[model samples]
Target: MYKNLTITSLLGALTIILGAFGAHALKKQLSVEAMQSFETAVRYQMYHVLVLLVINLYDGFSEKMKRTLTLLFTAGILFFSGSIYLINLFGVSAKSIWFITPLGGLLFIMGWSLLFYKFLKISLQK
Candidate 1:
């Protein structure tokens, strides 16, 4: 939990820094579409960071399960947000790698499904 907390906190911080950089540094450099895509990446990364923090607060899961949840969330952010960032900032055409974004979305959906399952299982036990 502590490890996830720390990782999430760092990720949160990076989200803020990147947001600021996008607003100020990349504002004039990138096209409007690219800027929007960059913002989408930052938003999703921050959203998952919050999800990680929330998961740390839940104590119903075993350590292994918690780790799995964390890994899934982390991977989701990496694949989803990472691909968006690359495409928007690094000039990687989205058409060339359209499959990656959906894969990341699938990871995010799986993470949420696992969380829901764990919480539901706990509620039934209670």
Candidate 2:
């Protein structure tokens, strides 16, 4: 839990930094579309990190459950947000890694599905 808290905190900080950098440093340099995409990446990353912070702090979840969700979300952030950053900031062609972005989105969906399943299972057990 502490590990996740630390990781989530760092990701949160990075999200803020990246957001500021996007709004200021890259605003004039990037096309409007690129800027929007970058903002999307930042939003997704920050959103998941916020969820992760809650998960880590909430004692309702077991350590194993927290770990699993963290793994899925962290992987999703890396692949989803990281790919967008690569494309917009580094000029990487989207075609070169066509499968990655979708795969990351799939990971994010899977994480949410797992949470839903866990809650349903718990409620049914009651």
Which candidate leads in TM-score?
Answer: 2
lDDT of 1: 0.89
Error of 2 at 71 (Å): 0.3
All candidates' TM-scores?
0.92, 0.97
lDDT for 69 in candidate 1 is: 90
lDDT of 2 by residue, 9-105 (tens): 9999999999999999999999999999999999999999999998889888999999999999999999999999999999999999888888899
* Candidate 1 ranges with C-alpha deviation above 4 Å: none
Query: How well does candidate 1 match the true structure, expressed as C-alpha RMSD?
Result: 1.3
| Residue-by-residue lDDT tens digits, candidate 1, 1-91 | 8988888898899899989999999999999988998999999999999989888877767878878999999889989998998887788
Clashing pairs in 2: none
* lDDT over C-alpha atoms for residue 11 of model 1: 87
